[model samples]
Target: MSRFSFNQITAKLWDLPDLVAGCVEAGVGQVALWREPVTEYGLERSAALVRDAGLSVTTLCRSGFFQAPDWFDDNRRAIDEAAALDTKVLVLVSGGLPAGSKDLAGARQHVADAIAELVPHAAAAGVTLAIEPLHPMYAADRCVISTWDQAMAIAEQHPVGQVGVTVDTYHLWWDDTVLDRIARAGERIAIYQLADWVTPLPQGVLTGRGLPGDGCIDMAAFHAAVEKAGYTGPIEVEVMNAELWERPGREILDATLTSYRKVV
Candidate 1:
């Protein structure tokens, strides 16, 4: 059976305790947390609460942002936090293209460099860094790693068993070679995320995602690919639409679980 988790991104806060409580109440057993909340709660405290509540943390939300001046420092801190939480994966969102720098290739290189620099720290902490490929639309501001193939190439540059990639359906659904790359990733498949995409609107990326069955993507195919790759991690629901965020938490959680079982 496929287990489920919630990405703190869907909750929009850095409070791991609150998010953990919500997940426990919903009968979810795992979570992927963002850095800010963990920083606030202290990694040890966050880990304690999750374990106390009988929940396992799936992965740390992210550790890379190469465009930032403090790239090296950022990742080091992320490794420390992941280790403290006893999390097995540290998801990295490779930085976006810097302003006036249309050089996508160069931005990707920066990501490689950062990962190379941080590998030792990650290994020492016993944490695996998982690269996350955002959709091409966020190519300019969010992440340069935009495809499974690209992420796999980056993973190859790292030492075996130290780095991997996170496959989020909301970002990979449009890719023609998603399955091919997921299979190639094999054990490098560290985190598998599930969310939906709706029609775009004026506000931003938030408007584009819907609940699982509400969208048109072939979720079963996507899940099959990950399973074929031997990925047995929690299926994380990471919806962040304004509508869902605004509704009562229980309603959103109920709808999410229903969609997960029925559509995912």
Candidate 2:
């Protein structure tokens, strides 16, 4: 059976302990956390709590924002943290267009450069850099790595187990060639992320995602493709929406888990 987990980015505003507790209470067997939450409670403390709660730490939320000149230092810290917590994957959200820059290609180049710099650190820590490609709508300000093809290019260039792509359905459900890309990713797909895309897209880049079965994404087919791609990893539930947040945390958690087991 496939176990499901929560992506901390979806509940970005919750306190760290509360987030973990909610997931455990809602029967989530694992959690993918963000760095800020880890920083808040400290990695060791958070890891201990998660273990005490009988939950696995699936992966960390993200570690790559390759657009900054000082990104190296920050990435090293993230790697160190992941190592300490015994987490396996540090999901990398390749950064957006830098201010005043119209060059998407150039920004992508920066991502490549950063990955080149971080690979050794990540490899040393035995942590994988899971590159998460955001949707094209966020092409300008969220992530330049917008396709599995682009992510595969980076992974092949690096050729390290410490580097692969994180597949998020909300970011990629609309892709015409998704099934093919999923097949291509195969073993290199490090993380399988799920979230529903509702109509009337939200204004801000982050908070529009609906829960699985709450939108029109063919999630069952998506799961089939993921399984066919040889990825048996936990399917990470990552919903970022104002409506979900406004509802009780337990309710959202229950709904997300139910939808994944039933619809996805």
Candidate 3:
């Protein structure tokens, strides 16, 4: 329970202030925030609110879409935002191949190069760039970095704290060799996220994640690997189910805590 940090997306409709108060009430001391909601709430204001509440921000949602024309500026802004929130890790989602482009290899390489270029800025801000490998189902449309190996390869190119990989149970559960690889990752492992993998994924494969233990993933194996890697960071529950969002936020948080207790 001490390691648990409730990711805000687990209750997407929950207001920022309400979420902070809810976390304090629930005894959740850490959080993972998204960009849009934080932006809407105002950057410094959100930071001050969380700071005043004594909440530790584990990481920001994401900021890497290498194909975008303004990717550099956008990522720099994200770095600044993460700094403002007093969070050390800024999640990076390497976007899909450019429109109508069949060059998967090219797109991935571009992501690595883009991260390399952004390293100085991230380092200057004292933020670690945590590359997230979305599930392979999203490789064609959402993310090109779709495996632990891919994320690690890019991360290993930079200094440890300046760049690292995200360990999300929903994405890595299907890979048989991932456990061993993750155990060997050591400091290259950044934040660890939890979202059970459900079958018959919804369209676009974005919002159908199950809470921990709701789906068929062997979550215990993941925990063992992360522990073996010597990672003591926040364990964020980041499910994105539409049905869950329809429920009350407090109910959702309680359910998430229950699910987390069962898995951990």
Worst 10 residues of 1 by lDDT: 199-208
Q: How would you encode candidate 2's per-residue C-alpha lDDT over 1-264 as one tens digit per residue?
A: 246888776666777788778976666778888888788888889888888888887888777777777788998998888887778888888888888999989888889878988898899889998888888877887789998788888887876577888888888888899877787677788888888888877786478888888888988888888888888888888888886777766676777777777775
RMSD, each candidate, Å? 1.9, 1.6, 0.9
Residues 1-264, candidate 3, lDDT per residue (tens digit)? 888999999999999999999999999999999999999999999999999999999999889988889999999999999999999999999988898899999999999999999999999999999999988988987799999999998999999999999999998898999999999999998899999988887774578999999899999999999999999989999999998999999999999999999999
Model 1 per-residue lDDT tens digits across residues 1-264: 248777777756335666677777778887777888777777778878988998878888777888988888878988888888778899899979887899998899888888888898899999999999988988999899988888989898877679988888889999998887787667888888888877654376745588787787789889888888888778888887876777666567677788889865
| lDDT at residue 12 of model 3 (Cα atoms) | 96
Candidate 1 versus the native: TM-score? 0.93
Question: Alpha carbon lDDT of residue 97, candidate 1?
Answer: 89
TM-scores of all candidate predictions against the true structure: 0.93, 0.94, 0.98
Candidate 2: RMSD to truth:
1.6
Higher-TM-score candidate of 2 and 3: 3
Report lDDT per candidate.
0.81, 0.82, 0.94
Off by over 4 Å in 1: 13-15, 200-202
**Lowest lDDT block of 10, candidate 3:** 197-206
Clashes of each: 2, 0, 0
